[model samples]
Target: MAEQRMPLPPLLLDGAEYHADPIRRALSALAGDRAGRFAPGDLAAAMGSDYTMTVTPGRASVPAPADGTGGVYLVESAAPVTLAVTPPHATRDRIDRLVAYVVPAQAGGTPGAWYLAVREGEPAASPVPPAVGAALVLYDLWVHSAASGRPIELSDMRLSGGQQMLAGGTLAGAERPATAPAGTVWTSTTTRQSWAYSGTAWRLLGVQDDTLASHALSGSRAWGPGVNEQAVDNLTFGPGRNGGLIELSAGVVHLSRPGRWALSMQAFSDDGTPGSSKVWLDWPGGPWLTRDLCDTRMRGGGFAGAGVLHQPISWTGVVTSDQALNAITIRGAFTPSTGGNRPSYMVWLYVDYLGR
Candidate 1:
């Protein structure tokens, strides 16, 4: 039995605005009596130009019939054209619903490429070509510079959605380094502060409360048969101020060096004798030199010399004497070097003694 061929539907080459007359005539000739009922091989042979048709999966390139209704159609134009097709409702397989063509190159003729995409079961107007929609959506796309890449110039680009352009790290807006300059010392701006550094430790500089206020020791003003018992008082000390007596009660005096020193006290005498007066000095933890007042005459009479005494003997061992009393007294001034480069010293006296 001979195979029966399906009848080709009519062809409606609608929207032929810019289609070449020769190409339309060629298509019409190929779709001769059954113009739309073209098989794959027949359609390929009919568009007799130098182009190729590649049918992807689920897609076919069949020919449209001549009649305008119930037949396939091809619309071609240059100034933007739309091709509309209405497939039968029963056409479920996408392969049976649409047709596309590629214009082939003729001898010595310039050939340009076009595009066609078909959606199944859509009405003639439903699948409008996306040129307008694509043009509208292109307004939303933008580009930005990455940290590792060169910065994008805003003047040469377009951006949407309030995007801001930032300069690159190599540009003037780069981040600054967070390091300090070498040899720059950090010191506090307070008078009561100190800066200290150890070779093996971190340097520290700050203000701390002076802790030698109520714990200092004083000395006797008068010499006596029972030892000079001095009632010393009225003292103030701090960092910049005098660091009062570091009371060493029979404590080990670490003598890193040795030199001439003196033991003196500011005092108030009540009975006008060296044995009957109140003296003020730091506590005695010294190998202090002694000053003899044997020939030193008393200024106010009655055996009491109301002044500081410079003891005139040098020693290095610790004096383990409990002869030091404490109200506000200091005992020794041991000069580590008698040659003038002495450690700085500051001393305070009782300018006003409000003893009750």
Candidate 2:
């Protein structure tokens, strides 16, 4: 979808009528553009004079920082305000509260009434500050019961506004943000993995680890054991062999992510015969009902029998579909000039994710 631009105010003509509402609308449009460009959070002040909280004997104060200077969120505290800390009770060890700048509801239909608010916490051994709803938090304070006139370490607890931050829990438990701007990132706390918003949905981030699955071969299966010999077969990963990243059935692979990927297969046998084999993703229906050979091997002169041939072949392509998952099948063909028994040993399949 194309991004919509905010409309600018029209140029004034000579002897034209001017209205206050048009000026206000222009200013609002500008502010809205700023809000869209930058994330909502605290902005730094000049000369290190910011909304840092300072604690006194019985009070906590913030220095007078100019309004519209500390943050791009278009809300600020114009004057310095101090709140009195509650006297600690003997039963409770500490009292906690959160200091924040809150934008309040308009009075008598007038707008832009922002003020400082203290979200108070209940007295407890280790008191936690209450949630600062619709407020930009500045500091979290904990007052001790026993210590009077004690030095309180005040750390600037404001969030930076320059970049979009990540938020999520486990892969299964955590719910992704219902709506996020494209390129936004979210980390799964349980898996320690990250996902990115792809304008439409959350896509897993980074190069995914290779998924490896092997299929054990049974008795002797010759590549070509007859005259005018040509054999075609599907290389498969055994049931339950999927690495949880992908799903496999026979030779078809099911991928959930929509992006570029690198897929590979290795078919090895003990019998080394004078034969040639080609592997590819099934496309244009060739001899094996598959075209576009990814890799091919020709074994001309080798001892026939008793060794593993670990020649891995790979193919790289982009997979996209209207459906959530994509399905691709792999097929291979072997042609031998003379009749030779090439007993199947094992088939190893790999799918490596590149990225979106």
- In model 2, which runs have C-alpha deviations exceeding 4 angstroms? 1-243, 283-291, 300-302, 305-309, 322-326, 342-345
Best by TM-score: 2
Tens digit per residue, CA lDDT, model 2, 151-171: 333334543232222222223
Model 2: how large is the Cα RMSD against the reference?
Answer: 16.0
RMSD per candidate (Å) reads 36.5, 16.0
Instruction: Name the lDDT of candidate 2.
Output: 0.46
Mind giving the per-residue lDDT tens digits that candidate 1 earns over 1-356?
A: 99966443234446433435345555444333122211112111111112122222221222232222222223332232233323233312111122333333442234433234332322232222222211101011111213223221111111122211211112111222232222122333432323232222213232244331222222232233333232223233323433222322232111111222223323322232221122223334433343212111222223334322332211223332232222123332212111222111122232111111
> Which candidate wins on lDDT?
2
lDDT to native, each model: 0.26, 0.46
Weakest ten-residue segment in model 2 by summed lDDT:
56-65
Give per-residue lDDT, candidate 1, residue 179: 26
275, model 2: CA deviation in Å?
Answer: 2.5
